[model samples]
Target: MVGSLVNSSLVGCDFSSSPTSRKPIVLAHGARRGDVVALSSIEALPTLAAFGEWLRKPGPWVGGFDFPFGLPRELVEHLGWPLEWQACMAHYAGLSRDEIREIFRAFCDGRPAGGKFAHRAFDRRAGSSPSMKWVNPPVAWMLHAAVPLLLAAGVDLPGLRPGDPARVALEAYPGLLARELIGRRSYKSDDRARQTPDRLIARKDLLARLETGQTRLALRLKLTHPQRDALVDDASGDRIDAVLCLVQAAWAEREGPPGWGLPPDLDPLEGWIVSA
Candidate 1:
């Protein structure tokens, strides 16, 4: 069921599969008031247990989390994983990280050079990394780490599974919106040495466009001066990415339920990214 957005807090999470004090999971808490999405606070969870604890808390909230929610259907079938969503997730969660990496590596090794990893349908649409990639962004590990927790927390994953209707969760990719605002110009880097002036300018330009409601979502970002500074000053882009996901959550909430602006043809086995 589509829960009442009027009373729901909109959340956007920039998740880290393996979180630490140095690089915690960042969550942006916000709500929509008419055309304006006001960011209220940003917080960090330093461990996966803390992240799970936060998920299990009471909710009349909708969240757009920056993590792959499902594996590619092709990959699952090739690996002979369960076809059923819940069952497949359970099988996946039972595997150790090393096992996962080995299995995925085998699959990739058999594929042609450029088309190494299998991709969910939405991956091409969203321009996201293949969910099976274990390095670089390590989104496969992200899915491995987060999905079970989401399932355990009993949050409603719109297309794939049903649980607490009030605690809705959607896959989000900030790059989708960021690219819309700034094209391909890089706006953030975890390396302090690479946090150049150009990236800082890019962040400001992106924020300016977002503040003016320049994207297709048409939702203005309402932030205090300090909030704006906090978002821009973080070279890692975790805070801004969380806010970007927050914007997507606001869009989904505004769209209301059933699909929540997700396509009617969304694959149940692979899941779709919100606002993709």
Candidate 2:
């Protein structure tokens, strides 16, 4: 696979809408080393464009981005959004934040609370994480809006797309991983300034798993002195997302994906990453 250079470790990403957002890029960098990579990181980025530009630039990487690749086929069909990825991106991009929320709300209103919206099968495995949820994370819209941009601009998504699959993209659900470890604790963060001590504690426990490589989905991270402190300091999960992405990069480096880890029934236009 073109993304073979990515590394055995998989980094988890917590994405933002644009550059202006204070949301720091979280990454879970992993490699064979002293290994504190599982802990949350607080990395900096000037802008969303700068971040996107980095994805195409190149390095050993494979990102398990915490976003959706495409909306539910059933949901899109019901809402009557454009059926194709390209057209869907245009349609999603065209909507204002308010308008998008309204449409999502209307869609939610029709369904039961727990059954409010449909989800991908992978999401079922991912559990009740909102980031994985089609409606909550709007990852489907993410796939709709972001993937084309990524493909056109030249990011890698091995076993999924041709050309340089350096920045192999996957719909990672940290919440899926987190829920198993921490359960219903408040892990997601909205404000950089408001990150609480509880988050730091949770990060500490999370780091234990990465250090010992306790879980089946463990990351191998090599953190610099600065990197370690930076990760330790982050109370919110943004910087941690970047660290997660680094771990994902390492995982891709280790694993070989023939089809970006997707099922045969998966949509080609939708794309997916291979899972172990």
Question: lDDT (CA) for every model shown?
Answer: 0.93, 0.56
lDDT of 1 by residue, 28-59 (tens): 99999878999999999999999999999988
Error of 2 at 77 (Å): 1.4
Off by over 4 Å in 2: 1-3, 6-12, 26-43, 58-60, 128-145, 158-161, 191-195, 224-226, 269-276
What is the per-residue lDDT of model 2 for residues 1-276, given as tens digits with 9 covering 90 to 100? Answer: 433553334456666545354554444544433233433334455565665665666655556776566556666777898877556656776776667767767887898878876664455665633322445455544554455566666655543455554456666655655554566676546676657788777776665454455555565444566765666676666665565545544444454555544565766434443342
Candidate 2 global TM-score: 0.74
**Residue-level lDDT for 136 in candidate 2:** 42
**TM-scores across all candidates?**
0.98, 0.74
